[model samples]
Target: MSVLNGISVSVGPVLFKAACPDCRSRFELAAGALRLAIGGSRRTTFYSFTCPECGSAVRKPAGERIVELLTGGGVRTLRLHSTV
Candidate 1:
């Protein structure tokens, strides 16, 4: 395992396996790339992404899918879809 910057490397067959924090359901993900959607009335920031497997309603109202990316000096995360 290679370490990029201070965070672990995220490449090759990246698998994001986690239980839905809301539903407590296990999820296995295999996405080609991380997705992001910018939104907000006053402040702009990184929001949650979406789930390809489960429908939009599963994580709606706000973002759901977020992936960890390693950069030159640090790590940046991008959301796949936003519920809101």
Candidate 2:
């Protein structure tokens, strides 16, 4: 169980589907296995994980919806700060 914005949320084992372009292998990864990075712009926002099959470090672009889902699913997130 978790709380967000004063709302109680159920915490479960969350798994996300991911594919490795290098090996063309597709698999599911747990929330702890993934990392989300929110950047200053859409182009910079993305998620990353290691390919279980090939052990390749993979990164994919994450949009608004992806960010919401990932954050809600309990994936660790890092906010990128940009100094202009």
Candidate 3:
């Protein structure tokens, strides 16, 4: 876990499915270690994925903004920040 800015980031393994925008291909993405970049240094955590047909990533990481990572999609940065 990493604290970035004022947010507590949690990095953990995740298994998800991704749909290709171009090919409309549906695949699975599994992460060994979820990465969370925090602070000014942007320290990151690591994760891994294993899938026979999944050879590529569904989406990229989030930018300097706070975003929600969807199952198949990438991170979604919202206009407002909230913690549940």
lDDT of 3 by residue, 1-84 (tens): 879999999976555654555466666654322233232222331122322454544333443432234322342222322343
Per-prediction TM-score, please?
0.31, 0.84, 0.27
- Name the regions of candidate 3 deviating beyond 4 angstroms: 1-13, 32-84
TM-score of 3: 0.27
Task: Report the lDDT tens digits of candidate 1 across residue range 1-84.
Answer: 679888897666554443445555666554432333344521333423344445443322322233123222122344344566
Cα-lDDT of candidate 2: 0.94
Tell me the tens digit of each residue's lDDT in model 2 across 1-84: 999999999977888988999999989999999999999999999999999999999999999999999999999999999887
Clashes of each: 11, 0, 5
Q: Candidate order by TM-score, highest to lowest? A: 2, 1, 3
lDDT assessment of candidate 3 = 0.40
> Can you list the residue pairs that collide in candidate 2?
none
lDDT of each: 0.40, 0.94, 0.40
Name the top TM-score candidate.
2
Deviation of model 2 at 71, angstroms: 0.4
Please report how far candidate 1 places residue 79 from its true position, in Å: 11
